[model samples]
Target: MLSGDLDISQAEGLKPMVYLVQPENFDQLGQSFVGKLLDSAEVDGRGHFEFEALKNVEGQVLLEVVVQKKGERYANRLENENPDSDNYMPLIWTRGETLVINAAIDQFQSSVTIENPSTVNASFLELRDLKKNAFLKYKNTLELLQGDEQLLEREKALHEYQAILMQFADATPELFPALMAIKWVSPEGNYERIPEFLVNQGVKWSERYPNDRWVKELAALASKEKLPILVGDQMSNLEFPMVDGSKTSLNAITDGKKLLVLDVWASWCAPCRLENRNVLLPLWQKYHDKGFQVIAYALESNRPAWENAIQKDGANRWLHASHLEGDQNPIMDSLRIHTIPANFILDGNGKVLAKNLHGEDLVQFVANYLGD
Candidate 1:
């Protein structure tokens, strides 16, 4: 059970949400609070709220207690233009234990305190302070630099920032915060440090428990980072709701095509739209009738934005599909598409021949395969 007390008197009409995040997708907490809303409670006259329905939930998932504003569908990152801050705190809950919290209304995280913290979360405060201090130091030292800064000083700052993360990970190798810190150390999302850190930490843990699936899964993330679902691999048979609210299947769409280009993109991505209009659209116009097709597959969250981009790009002639789940899309996960504007060339059988084609090279590739 998770119970908390907050003085909503300073700011009324807002709601408190408890987001239950899966260990694998814990990064969602940094983004927004939507389908992850495990439970919510009203702040009573006594300034108290409680969530007891988490007993049926499995595993040691991260919890986010956020105060969402009225009329707002969800709370994302703070807008620097608006100056108002988002009120929330990260938490980890263990079953069979009661975690109590007390936080202020104005400064949610600054004055927060916990009672009966989980064993895994015991080092949270220390790590949190280190992170906060490191960020301040970065802002004061690095962010203020205009170009006269030494390359070595910059590297030292980055190293220090990274070391704080590594310090936390090394201190609590099995903790979820440690895993989260790993996400930052590797800016590309895929690098040597990811699996290296996991394996290094798991050395002692694995000796104690050889068949630990946690260690296995953490190690497995490294392979997925290599983008294993491309070049000779057959596309997964899947269907998604189109703009017309009709379901479209990838395999079904490629039925009679000599070649099909799967363009994975999002509306927010400027390069994606630019490529669609400048490159992909023209390619479709030229080669579409000559046994070629394009599936404008969107890893999008907004239906209106997705539809607007399609209409604006004049890509109505091509096939389009999306579940509108954005990062939560299962296809993106299965495909291991960590970046946008990503594409793949698939044959009639839906087997990928080449991946990430764009600009002149993409046009040349099409010409080589299906000459104009």
Candidate 2:
């Protein structure tokens, strides 16, 4: 049972509705809250609420409590303004423990305190803060180092930071907190880290605790990140809905074109944005009339960043579509795309010709085909 006492006396005019949400996917840069609604409650006049008997919800999961004055409208406003902040704290619930929360309306996190099941989560929260501070220091140190010659040194520094994060993950008593720490420190939805952090760590934990339910759950989650797509596979079709509520498919844009660049990217991806602005846009402008088309497939959780990126990056002329589920999209399941700025050059009949041909190489590929 999850029970909380809301303190609205501190800040008036706040709504009484509180929503419990589950994680769906990360926004572009491991930011934003894209999740499914699990439960909701309206606090009484005395600011009391309870979610009792949450049955059949098996395994370890991170639950978010979203309390607000204006439901959805306020959430949307936060997404538009920040695109990152959740405006709430995450509850890392473990087995055989019920989480109790006390939060005020003025500043949710500032006034919030965890009461029950504090043994594991207290240390986890402290470790997370330390990791944040360490990363900040790492960034500052990186900024001081300049030039290509020092890139190896920079990489070393990053690896050391990752090591500290891995240590924290290992030290956690629960699987969920460990996994959460890994995600918190690692790059956004990075497939490489899945193996190093999740896969490897999961195996060790599973062997150590053969009968542990949390370990099994952690392994199951890690298994989902395995790469399924390859370079030579036939390009799969995706019917993604567009900005105007209209829908478009991959086959539709690939038709009647000699070649098409299936650009898989996201708005929060700085490298992807840079390539779109500096290289892809220019190439698209030059060869658009010559049967060389570009279709930008955004892996984004929010509509604003996805749409704004299209307009801001001059990619509006080309075909664009996203489910706004980011890495969790069904399309990604069939496509097996693990990373952004990834592309597959498709032939006239929608066969994969070349994979990830960027910048001058992309220009050369199209130019070679067009005999320019």
Candidate 3:
């Protein structure tokens, strides 16, 4: 059972309600991709609430406690909403233990403190706070440095941060916190390989916490064969319905004829919007007739917003497709994409020629390949 007391005595106006949310792995737009409304209750005049949860035997589950006005609509924490206003805080749960939380409405996230068997959760919080403090301390110092000096300072800070996290993970005596902290800064991009230190730690953790969900997930991530698709790898096939109810497929459109740029993006992603305006558009104009095509596959939940972005960004020239399922879209899952503004450039033979080409590099890559 999970129980908590919300000290909303200082809160003004409407009576607040507390919601127990089984938060999704990632957020879609302003909402959880697949959040389950596990439980909800109106806080009494004294401000207390409780909910029974199934034992998380496999591993820790990330649950969210959302406190808001009785009928007020608001966005989830990942949507960049006012965190303090929503009184958002993430909670972790494990099997065979009862957890309690005490939070004041005014203080919310920062003032949150847990009770009984929250050792792992508490340690993770402390680690995160340490990182936050480092960022604050170095914010001004970073601005004063130039070029390589700035880069070196930032790298030094990152290394120090990782060392501190490792020390916490080593001494915490909890698999959940250790696994999370180790995986948090795992490598990605062209060098999509887990660090040796993390791999060794994962091996020890797996031995310690056998059949643990996160351990297995981290082990898979640490595995060499699980690397992300690179520039030379074959592109994953994706087929889905367009807004007009027309079907689109990467293989079908490319058809081993024109080179295809598989642009995986979303309307809500600011980086995606910037790349479309500054990179994709110019490349399209230069290479369209020379047998280059762009399949702008949008991962969006809102049909109107997706269409609006296309119109606003002048991206209607290419074939666009999406089921508007956002992060829940199967195509996204197949590609193992958790972030947006990702792309793959495919040759006429339906093999990946390059990936994540950007700015002048995007134009140059296409122009060089086509001999234009």
Best by TM-score: 1
Which rank order by lDDT, best down to worst? 2, 1, 3
- Candidate 1 Cα errors over 4 Å, as ranges: 7-35, 58-61, 69-71, 75-88, 147-155, 184-214, 223-372
lDDT of each: 0.66, 0.67, 0.64
RMSD of each: 13.5, 13.4, 12.1
Q: Lowest-lDDT window of 10 residues in candidate 1?
A: 77-86
Candidate 2: tens digits of C-alpha lDDT, residues 1-372: 777887878646456767666664333212344566677777888888886435546665567666655535533112211112224555666545677888775556445577854655676556545565566667777988786545434655666667777888777676555655666655454544234456667687788786776566656756634643434557777686776778988788788998888888888876678778888888888888888888777888889888899899888888887888878887767766666567778887888777766667778988898768
Q: Write the per-residue lDDT of candidate 1 for residues 1-372, one digit (tens) a residue.
A: 788887666765555443333333623434443326666666677778887678877766676666666677654422111102435556677776688888765556445678866565556555555666665676577765554224334545665676887777777655556655564454335543234454555454455445656545545554434544736677888676777789878888889999999888888876777778888889999998899998877988888888999999998889888888886787677676666667889999989888776777789999899987
Error of 2 at 267 (Å): 25
User: In candidate 3, what are the lDDT values of residues 1-372, reduced to their tens digit?
Assistant: 677787886777534766767654322112443456566666777878777545433465666666654456543322212223435556678655688888886556555678754666787567545544544454545567566323434444555545665666666676655654563332121123224455556577778876866667657655534545555667656676876888877678888556888888888876677777777887788888888888888989899999999988878877788978877887767665565566778887668777666556678888888877
Count of residue pairs whose backbone atoms collide, per candidate: 0, 1, 0
Give TM-scores for every candidate, taking all chains together and pairing residue i with residue i: 0.48, 0.43, 0.45
In order of TM-score, best first, we have: 1, 3, 2
- Residue 227 deviation, candidate 2, in Å? 7.9
